[model samples]
Target chain A: MTNRWGLPHLGYGVGLRTVHYAEILSRWPAVDFFEAITENFLDTGGRPLHILDRVAERYPVVLHGVSLSIGSTDPLDLDYLAKVNRLARRVKARWVTDHLCWTGVAGKNVHDLLPLPYTEGVLAHVARRLRTVMDFLERPVFLENPSTYLQFTQSTMTEPEFLSELCERAGTGLLLDVNNVYVSAVNHGFDPVSYIDALPRGRVVQYHLAGHTDKGTHVLDTHSTRPRDEVWDLYAHAVERLGEAATLYEWDEDIPDFATVHAEALKARGLAAGIHREEVAVA
Target chain B: MPEPLTLDLVERWMQTVLVHPESAEAGIQSSPARALIDPGRVSEVVLASGHLTVAERLGIYQEMYLLRMRDALESDYPNLARHLGPHRFWHFVSDYVEAHPSRSYTLNRLGDHVPAFAATWGKRKERGLISDLSRLELALTRVFDAPEDPPVSPEALARLTPEASTELRLSPVAAFALERVRSASLRLLDSPEREVVPREAVPGSRHVHVLFVRKGGQVSRRTLEGAEGHLLEALTSGIPLGRALTRLGRRHRTTRPCEVESWFREWVEEGVFSAASLDPDP
Candidate 1:
């Protein structure tokens, strides 16, 4: 099913990283879209922004931010939100996204996506803030589930439940990271499939797949390499459940050549195609 | 029987733990964390799941915090990191973050204080060199990301008569920065291979002035000669060309019309001046 806002399913894409800038500008690779980190281009009038303009002109570009701090208790950074809005308009971005997490508090940024408690009070708080963000951008904001290493004991509900209710209250969309679901599942002992199943159907507008390091005891969402087999399996399940959504393959750390990273992202097309075939057979 | 934590309290506690310089155990026992939640009640606040205990899970964040800060700083101050080497650089980053944790949304500004921090750090003798290196590197970074302004074209400069040029006020492009450092720091940066070594202040080390400017999306450095640095500095400070040249003549005895012409031609060619407007009153 298409998202409620009718956001397009822009097929498979990869992050617009600095290492691949020359290749992208010269070759204009066949990736469907490029997700530019909002903060990277927001504060610079440099080569990164220049390349993003060229890439956005050729392909669909979306803004994936890490510093929205949507869940932080501090007053919303209006300056930051204004910059994000300006950037979105500058690039003609299809959508803007940040994590359903906080980065810091007391006027300091830790630069890490800190998970939030899934209590009723927190849900209402985040939903209220999400609405303010959506209104400021004048578009539906998609919040990705962060790959959390720990859970708050005060959480009264599962993460998916909290997210589902949050979308209902805030009119927001979801950028479901299948790998995050798997990582959080193992880290917090929840069912990954059930986590996907719990998300409201029409709210999921995008998918994020990435490689994570398995430390035997727990997992770190390093995004250093290719997705593991289990993550691909989860992506297939999500495709079958949520229908086609814009999928992005993230490889931030030790990223390979453009062909290699694009090839990893292309793997999603095949998995998603297979899921569609099964749906056709059932119909 | 402790009071239930609110979202505000939880964030404060976690941020305190994550940014604490010591171990996660110490972070939990930190005064800031203790002010919100009892140190003994960490497990009660943060759940232990799978094979990892509460402290270990919390440690994941603590470890990643330093790693993230290191990555950000290393990207901005690559030469500084290389000079300090892995061990010393890691410790420097740890102390640096503890002293000045990130307060901005973007990591681009995180290293704004690196040069200042470096000036007072390390051995007293080597501090100046390291600080100068950091200042040079930071200037390059700033120039790379500075606002893009079309450089003044040669045609524009040619359009002005010699008399008109004397009253012209030249504005440097936003993507330009001037750095003055010791000659030894520039030599170290120019060296092919960089490694951590004991650096002592050289006797009678001369100061070097360099200009960093971006042209066509690439940053380039130029070492200033004669009194060009003073003239450029004066012009960029809003002095008209005539006045700046007069000031340069007083500042440097070697200033000559021939040398000034050559410097002006090179500066215009190098895209140093973004715009040149005649001084309205003059």
Candidate 2:
């Protein structure tokens, strides 16, 4: 009974940001949909929402939140969730997603998507919490693998195995971060493609592609550069397995321009198109 | 390795990564092409070694992120930025971010606590002028970003007889509030060019009234006093046109009517309101 995403394919998308706001509106770019940061439009009856309203009229919008902090031991932030949920309905968003990590505890926000150890009890904890949240949202939550710098010595499960289990238990979807795969594989020393193959095809409902920083040993998910060739290969591998979900090209810091980000997104679309054509050829 | 106690190990790992990055070791082998390090031993162990330590590079993120955020606050609130000057403003921001790294995901909501932060920090005399400047700056954006409302327009006003004038309802965009504070605060804000007046006590000055509104999707801020501001506040907040006028007249009977008339007309031109909320006859 689990559907993947807004089907008939949303093609490829880019994180619609303020820098490219003028460009997208002025030209009505060729993107199938724009992924908006839900927090940006929430409580914004202002110009941000003004432009968002116009964009929503033309294209599908997906609401992504950073502060939902659903994993926190703290009681689900009901007020924050309600606000974002209302805005999601406002823009008719496709799906909502947040990281598979805790943001804070004891009512203080630590900001970073800190890692959670892969273990049986922790899986139970996450599954129970996500079930509560998904029930409240009344929709499938797409939990993403974070670009992690560290791991727990106590972890008994491979990251992929743990993720696979969570999807089964919570009945949620996965927004696989290919760049995070490359980043984590390199940072933790593993085969990125192997990690991709381990994911349950049914769970991966979306895909995120972005660039990261390699300042030597650790790779930072800065999303400030073009997606590296290695990450692109991993993305291709993911498409072969996960098929085409809602693929997004994310360029946050040092964002070049609308044209550049759009073109990058086009590359993902081209890849997806290739996948579709290949699927048709086989069919 | 012993299986980490489920929740206990997860919390420990999170605490380790949340505070620092170089913790944990995992099963993956280091591929120069792939790039992730040993996730097992990194617990309290950063991978950056040779050229720059993890501390050094991560320091760059910590510094730049903090500066980038502080720069946003400074740019948005010029008067406050000027008051704090360059070094002192950053000093406070650096300290503040370290004390309270943002919990929220969006950069848009990062500075909501800034005004309150300023009140506490400025009162401590760390970087004075933070509270008012933060408030004024926030007011500007709040006014600009506030939802638009329909108001009683000129045509509606024209139909009102002198008898109806007693209930002169304010337009939605006609919002103004008087915030009195010690010293000559707002005079420094307005000018063809405000000469940088050094921070010092302004002797004998009392409170100053403030104005706030969004015009054409941008915040418009200024100063207003007494009856006019009260008259406008009343009308926009749902008082009828007749009652608002009576309130204004009672408060400012001493002032000449013509001056108040010109002020009201100027606000109308600023895209303040569409028309009053409630009306009759028309």
- The lDDT leader among the candidates is 1
Per-residue lDDT tens digits for candidate 1, residues B1-282, read 787788898899888988877778889988878888898888778998868889888999998999999999998888888899999999999989988899999999999999999988888999999999999888888888888999999898999998987899988999998887886777556422212222333333677677888888767777775488778888887899888888888889777799888888888887999988985653
Off by over 4 Å in 2: A1-6, A275-283, B1-86, B94-110, B119-128, B167-210, B216-218, B222-254, B271-282
DockQ list for all candidates:
0.83, 0.26
Candidate 2, residue B240: lDDT: 76
Deviation in angstroms for A49 in model 1? Answer: 0.9
Instruction: Show pairs that collide, candidate 1.
Output: none
Q: A193-281, model 1: which lDDT tens digit per residue?
A: 98988887777899999999989989999899899999999999898887788999999999899999999889899889888888899
The TM-score that candidate 2 achieves is: 0.78
TM-score of chain B of each: 0.91, 0.65
Native A-B contacts reproduced, model 1? 0.95
Compose the digit string of candidate 2's lDDT tens values, residues B228-255. 6666667666777666666777777886
**Reference-based lDDT, residue A268, model 1:** 95
